[model samples]
Target: MPFNWNWAFTWEILPKLLHAALNTLLAAGLGYAIAVVLGLILALAQRTPSRAVTFVIREFVEFIRSTPLILQIFFVYYVGPQFGLRLGPWTAGMIAIGLHYSAYLSEVYRGGLQAVPKGQWEACTALNLSPAKTYWRIIIPQAIPSALAGMGNYLVGIFKDTPMLSVIGVAELMHTANAIGSSSYRYLEPYTLVGIIFLAISLPTAALIRIFEGYVRRKLGLK
Candidate 1:
């Protein structure tokens, strides 16, 4: 016997996979939103005058970055109940993914912030602009051009990682593929489609990130 690809079966399973991909997109979007805000806070906290706060936050970021994301997902979904924090699979997956990526994104933000020349800070100080004004008006605007590439990379990264949500049974693409394969006993088409679907999304996303990065640089006058 020889292996053969079944176009009919591939077409049949695609709609289910596409529906599941929507869940994956939702997870990535929500998780990235959390990461963006939390990462900014983490980066800014590291810049404050309070050494203890900086140390604690720096170490916490390190802790999250150093560990495997899957373990964090398991801990949040399984262990949280012991602390009376019961979260459904979707909630737990999002929190774990968001926190995991926030640590990485904070480093990206820190690099961007540091890339801003000391002269900018001096100008802000000379103008006597309040810290909030300095950051929101001057600093963040400048830092963003430097940060946009890294931010875009992480957006794609989050999208790819959404498959991990399947482990906890969140019904993302991989999970749905697994279900289809198990029920039909036809692993070949299902898994192949998953790969093609991921490639379809990730490659274009990376290219768009590059385009967006260039746009941001030009808009910020960094080009």
Candidate 2:
């Protein structure tokens, strides 16, 4: 089979795809922000002194983390209206992404917290630090550096997974590609462009994450 590549087609579709790409980025950014904050809350809940409460929190996190995100999105988009809860495509996508990633982020927080030595906690106790003061002033400061890479990795993870939002009719880059392909009956240009756009965004974001991680490590005197 002879293959034909059309520069004209690529150029024409690029702008539309770029527009959709912005929505994808927006969804990822908002979802990641929510995930970071919500995950911290869940992680803290798991560490609370009450055994029953901690168990419940841990189980909830486990349930979410174990499930497939696609299913979650379906539930959010389709089942939501049954309870008189309705959301637009973008809103539903953002909520699903936030909720799904929060479970994973909670584990990241838990791991970072655990990495802090028992000696550090003992030292805080010896200093007669209140629990809140100890965590706020010492433990969290120590934990941030350890959590940086994991948090950064998830930022890129969320970006890559933005395509999944297309499943629920969210008009992100992947959905744009699908529309273009369906209209033009050509898959190569649009699909390849989508891949290129993802690489362009994710590669730079990942590099930035690495730079931040290095800076964090240096500040913490870890290396």
Candidate 3:
């Protein structure tokens, strides 16, 4: 059959897809939030004095970065139940995505932390500042600018990766699109709208991230 764009079908399914888009956003947002915290911990853990601790965390981060995200999602949702940890699709998806991105974000943070000058570390020591205070008040503040760009990129990346959650039945946008297409037998409109919706959100988000990065730099007086 020749390709035809059906306005009626498109309009009818718009609300369902839009509702699922909120799930997409929720997965991305909560996963990124988890990644932001856990990635920092992993990065800082590698900086600790004990070589054993650093080596273990370093290997763990590398392992996570090396693996496929889909495997992680499957493992968490399926295998986890074998270990007596039964979680819903939403929870499993969030944990999997969060851990996956945390590895990437940890590298971003490590680079940012390293970019801080040695002089600053010495300055903190000379001032008799505690390790916790030095890191929290000074090192992290300076590192934010260097890490902000990578962080923003991963924010978008995690959003894109949310489609993978559909495999585990997370009911994100792609899942809804697939369901709509399966029932209605209209693949083009549903898939096309999915792309358009992603573009609609992602393009503006990329622009806003740039603006926010600039604002952060200026506010930190690093501009």
- lDDT tens per residue, model 1, 1-223: 1179889998999999999888888999999999999999999999999999999999999999999999999999999899888999999999999999999999999999999999999999999999999999999988888888889999999999998899999989999999998898899998889999999999999998998888877776775
Worst 10 residues of 3 by lDDT: 1-10
Candidates ranked, most accurate by TM-score first: 3, 1, 2
RMSD of each: 1.2, 1.7, 1.0
Highest lDDT: give the candidate number.
Answer: 3
lDDT of 2: 0.91
lDDT of residue 143 for candidate 1: 88
lDDT, model 2, position 131: 95
Q: What is the lDDT of residue 15 in candidate 1?
A: 96
Candidate 2 lDDT, 109-208, residue by residue in tens: 9999999999999999999999999989989888888888889999999999989999999999999999999988889899999999999999999999
Q: State the TM-score for model 1.
A: 0.97
Off by over 4 Å in 3: none
Q: Each prediction's Cα lDDT score?
A: 0.93, 0.91, 0.96
Residue 12 error, candidate 3, Å: 0.3
Compose the digit string of candidate 3's lDDT tens values, residues 1-223.
Answer: 3289999989999999999999999999999999999999999999999999999999999999999999999999998889888899999999999999999999999999999999999999999999999999989999999999999999999999999999999999999999988888889999999999999999999999999999999998896
Q: Name model 2 segments beyond 4 Å from true.
A: 1-3
Clashes of each: 0, 0, 0
